[model samples]
Target chain A: MWEIARSNKRKSVIFVFLMALLLVLMGGVFGEHFAQSAETGLLVAFVIWVILSIIAYFQGRNVFLAVSGAHKIRKEDHPRLFNIVEEMTIASLLPAIPEIYIIDDPAPNAFAVGRKPDSAAVAVTSGLLNTLNRDELQGVIAHEIGHIINRDTLFMSMLGVMLGSIVILSEIARRSLFFGGGRRRTRTSSSGGGQIQVILMIAGLVLMLLAPILARLIYLAASRKREYLADASAAIFTRLPEGLASALEKISVSPIRLRKINQVTAPMYTINPLQNMKLAEDSLFSTHPSTLNRVRILRSMAGGSGYDAYDAAFRAVTGQTRAIIPPSALKTAHATVPSRSRRSDPKSDPGTDQTKQAPSAMGMAGAVLTAAVLMDAAAEPVTPAAKVRETTDAIWKSRGYRFIPCPCGAALKVPPDYRRTDIVCLRCGRKHPAASAS
Target chain B: MECPVCRESMIVIEYDDIELDYCVGCMGVWFDAGEIELMLGKSGIPFPSEALRFRVADTDARELRRPCPLCGKTMQKVCPEHGRVILDRCPAGEGIWFDAGEIREVIKESAGAAGDIVLGALRRYLGEALAEK
Candidate 1:
């Protein structure tokens, strides 16, 4: 994992240099041909880069979050989410817990952003919180933290800002040329040197059209790699490949669309937030790798929750292992194969894994019981047991357990274990069928 | 925004830039004008692009009529996605009101290629646990 992070850092540096060179060349050509000053073109490009860099450095996360309609949330606003994030942070040994936010949109999606781990923020959609259970949510959160730990968010957001600027600049250039703003210069430049200059100008124009596309391809390629590395980190941190694998399945399969996602920031999400945009799995322009392929790689990791096991699974699933998880990382990885069946009644269900620990009602109860016992032993009641139970219930309700609103104005929660088809509302004694509540 | 039915102050909830008027007392939501469309956009399902459109005839089954919260004018009955999901829209086109969990139902049942894919993937990946039945 360290090796992967190092390589990512190295590649990021190279990409930055490449982007700068492209900008300088394009700007120099535009100045020399149109403005009659290479200095002017270079200055314009430099200024654009500087401005975009400042924006990305200071407010990139905010811009993306705002665009996605995410609002900052306190721990009290969502204790279950806070708890899961806290767990992932502790497990990863992150210096500080990332600020949490929730988008009101029903799309089951999540992303992390910040230049550094301590400053990072993780945001998940309301739909995601509703759809995924505890383990699945943890898997997704761990993956986001992986991006933070690997320092991928900075590079990814920087690339987004740069690539977006290039696209905008290209659009402006194309429009100016299309409207004949350069026709006067072309007509006057009839000298031999002028012809060479004109040719260079045309070449530059062609490059302008192609540069953004090329930049995007490079960005997507890098984005895909970062995703795989994050997955590996998530599994390594949680020691539960199936948790994230199932989560990947749920997220990808969710048709809920993000209201404000675009090509630039799409790569930052756990799964491509815009996967519903109809891009092919292996399309050169796709932001993330095929979620199906990702799920397969995760599912194949039967050995252990180590980099080596993940590498083996990735190799078995993708047939080429050279690009992701490096050899050095595998050497340090442990050899304990993870238990695939961690819960009872595995064979009866083929679709969703009903592992007792994966956020089911029963599992939630078990967690509460364990926490209560630990708190009792500690003799320090930071959060009252009743408070913990209420929060747990709130989490379940958020995940779509039926809440019965009685005439007495109190909302009665229908417990998941109630076997009777009809039951009286505990608060108002109103009889209602169980099926109607859902 | 206030709830038309309960006449209670509604909480202003933000989903992206789209703000919803949510009634705490009744657990209802009001989407002003294009707010529902904005929320629907997040679902990534394309707006109706076909030449021929299908509409479900209004049955007026919901007898409890609530006036428009924005204008206090009587609202029209609207079944946005077939007749299964009924909502009240202002006659003046101001907004629509939905009780709590109706949006979830709309999202869950909306038929589209993307929705089908996710549902199929869920079944394949999680099996019986995903099927509520």
Candidate 2:
């Protein structure tokens, strides 16, 4: 179980206080109506708020799915993708099958959200499929399952809906008042309903403006701690830290970054979705712990046989044991993954080849190792980052660039960056910028 | 198309005319970095929004990574996120590598973002035309 940090707990308390403030402000506005009329309007208002919020809880998934335009998929359209999800779900033993959605995108990414596994959803971009091999793909899928099983999906979605409601309602209030919510107040108070009513109406308008901020405070309170819990759960679900490490590395390298994803919904993913912070700078406002930090934690786990390593990894990444996966049961739990596809695409036929070994493009381990051993750690991420005098330029020099997918099963193929002006792919007939300069 | 990983000869069996140069051997693609955008053209992404950049992330903020897979030199990194999706941009501006199923993910993630990008661009284009009028 993930422990809630004192800092976060205090934040939650503050959020509840803000909520209480919003309600109290509302009560003040209507207090007058009930004071004069013996109708129990305050009781009625409170009931209505409770009823609507409850309804929202049950139906929140539908709204999120629809708004995000996530479409459901069967194992048929994408058997490999679907099977990986199934394996992860069974390994995690989640109560209900989370809805799987596919978005037509070129970016390598995936996310989980909804009220519960029963109402949970897992969405992935088409690009993720193209980028990862079976093992790497399985790692990402299991990570998503970790989110569902831990109920982080539900937590984040609930928070997103709550925040959405605040924004939508405040916008409505602003519009209605402009058209006239105050019109009724003016008419109702005409007979002598003087200063107090005007003051109350003003108060209501001000509350309307503050509602979205209050909603966010609630989300921030609810989010940060839950992230620590999910990370631990992910590590438990997928024994090999290398798989996730590789997945993150691939995601990090892909040109299409996930910018549309936001704070309210980001916690539902296996990794933090914030794009602004550099990996090194992530200890501060990032909801998901930094990838390197998580990798370090996992690497520590790989090295140690005892509980101390686990403790150290958890504490270092999460700052404390808000959530934990015990060594005993966690070890026994069989985290599952889809078996590799043995099918051979003639182009990347791995067999009958020698000399040039296919770039295993496995985890960042290859990169990390190369960095740790061959080059300084400081220069490692730099090679993958850009302009490293590596093989990227050599391929272009011999022949005009071609848009060929590598043997890795990654669907995209790029040309050299130096010759970036305009490219004519002899094979694909598509003209593109050299190495995606756009 | 060339292989993105090892940049060798490749053949794309999926989709019509979208013969990506993937190393039939290594399973990587040669995106030519900018080639991905040329392939996606106008109809990219999920539901009315830009996706590629918004889907994956690299906080290191290095645009330098964009480069030719074959040359082993840095190519320009474009977000491939489609417009403001804004991931690492390839300055060399050619080709992209969609590791296997990334094409599907790119389209799926871009659903909303693509729609938004298309509409916005069309609106701006038409607005510019009207202004000229």
Candidate 3:
């Protein structure tokens, strides 16, 4: 794991360095065309890059959470999600558990963010919790943790900031040129170096137009491979490739598109939220491998849930000789997959059994879902409606909505802005006072 | 979100995981498109995509146009087949708006078990607020 993460970090640094160089070149060209000196543009671009990188290093995670409207939740708010995250954290051998957040949107997606593993956070949509089963949810959380462990979050942020700066600089230059603000500078420089100045201006204009697209391609190229690595990491951590494969299937087929996502944050998601369903095939501009390909790779991992197995599966599915997992990481990989029955059997594994017990005990106290329900879920799948309700209830709880349980087995959620002092129960026609209920 | 009918800030009421934005002033309900699909889909009922699709009903031309609570665009009156309940659906497919009495009427007019399940859930939750004529 360390070897894989270290190699990933090394590759990330190279990508960031190359993108930074691209940004500086763009700045220099635009500056020469507009301000008549490459030094000023280069310095300006460098300063912009430094400032943006600093901000991303310190506050990128918070900015992402705020932009996506994710609200942080405590263990009591959503124990199931918290438990899954904790289990994955332990399984991945991380030093600290990442903070958990929930997005209210019904789109089933998730992402991880932070500059370091210890400070990282994982966020999932309410739709995700509502949609996925326990095994599937675990698979998704493990995948996000895969990103954190692989240092993809920090790398992606730095790359995103560089991408942003390139886009902004080019946009400003394009607008300035379009509005004829560069004409005066061109005319002034024309007297000193007439022919060369005209050539330089045209070259700068072309560069400015091509710079953003180039930066986006670089960003997308860097992003797509990391997703496969993370997927492999998730499989090894959970020992359940089917969980992730099915979850990807559900996510890809989901009809609802994420409302709050933008170009910059789109790649951070488990799946590219911005990609249209019809256009989900592999493309130069795509931030992720095609879902079909990813799922096929995971499903075809015949040997075991290991880096070596994933490598073989990748080759089989894509018909490419190139390996996805680093050879060094594969040296220390597990030889065999643990059986599914052993994992499901609470008595067989004490470590996992303890984790399950904690949540079930808490569930008993809250009267949310009893041990019997959990057991039933383990045996036969629970209805999607029940899972959706449980997940949404957690979101409401995090947002300060009060839950009032009625005798008719209905738990009514009263909004914070509910002005009425007394509210009637939606079930059983029983009336309860809002002030006293809380 | 502000109610399109009464223009009053609405209070969200969550029951069985489906959130309904209810206007206290007019007793009207706003059913978001996403939530409706989730509710129907989870319940194993086929989503009434045809009924909810943007179709301008020429019958209610005299009714004042109401802006959709979500997109702020003027909503078109759509009357689902097999029902006389004219609903204000966002042209952008945001959601549907039902006046106080219209919800019950739509439920009554709706075909098969799909309507009964929704009606039962709504009646159980909203009680007299939805039962009122």
* Top model number, lDDT: 3
Candidate 3 lDDT tens digits, A1-438: 555787787788888888988998898888777776788889888888889888999989999999999999999888878988998998788889999999999999999999899999999999898788778888999999999999999889989999999998888887878796656664565386777777887888788888899999999999999999999989877877888988999988999999998999999999999888622667898999999989999989873677777889999988889988887777663423332322454554434433344545553322221112123234323887677777877887788777777666566666676677766653344677877644
Docking class of 1: incorrect
Which sections of candidate 3 miss by over 4 Å? A180-192, A277-281, A333-381, A408-410, A426-429, A436-438, B1-125, B130-133
lDDT of 2 at B118: 46
Model 3 docking category: acceptable
Interface RMSD of 2: 14.3
What TM-score does chain A reach in every model? 0.78, 0.57, 0.87
Candidate 1, Cα interface RMSD:
15.7
Residues A1-438, candidate 2: write the lDDT tens digits.
Answer: 222222233454565566545554544444443243224434544555566567657776675556555667665446566777776676566767777786555567787776656667788766676667665676787777766665666556544554655565456456766775655765677667677767766766677777667666566555654554454455444444556667777776666756456666565555555555435534434556566666666555543322234456667765765434443323331221111112232342223332133336433322111101111122211322122112222223223334434233223344333223544333233544445531
Query: DockQ winner among the candidates?
Result: 3
Would you list the C-alpha lDDT of every candidate in the order shown? Answer: 0.68, 0.50, 0.79
All predictions: root-mean-square deviation over Cα? 13.9, 18.7, 8.0
- TM-score of predicted chain B versus true chain B for each candidate: 0.67, 0.43, 0.78
Task: Give residue A97's lDDT in candidate 1 (0 to 100).
Answer: 93
Clashing pairs in 3: A426-B125
TM-score computed on alpha carbons, candidate 1: 0.66
Clashing pairs in 1: A69-B16, A253-B118, A257-B42, A257-B43, A303-A337, A351-B125, A351-B126, A351-B127, A352-B126, A352-B127
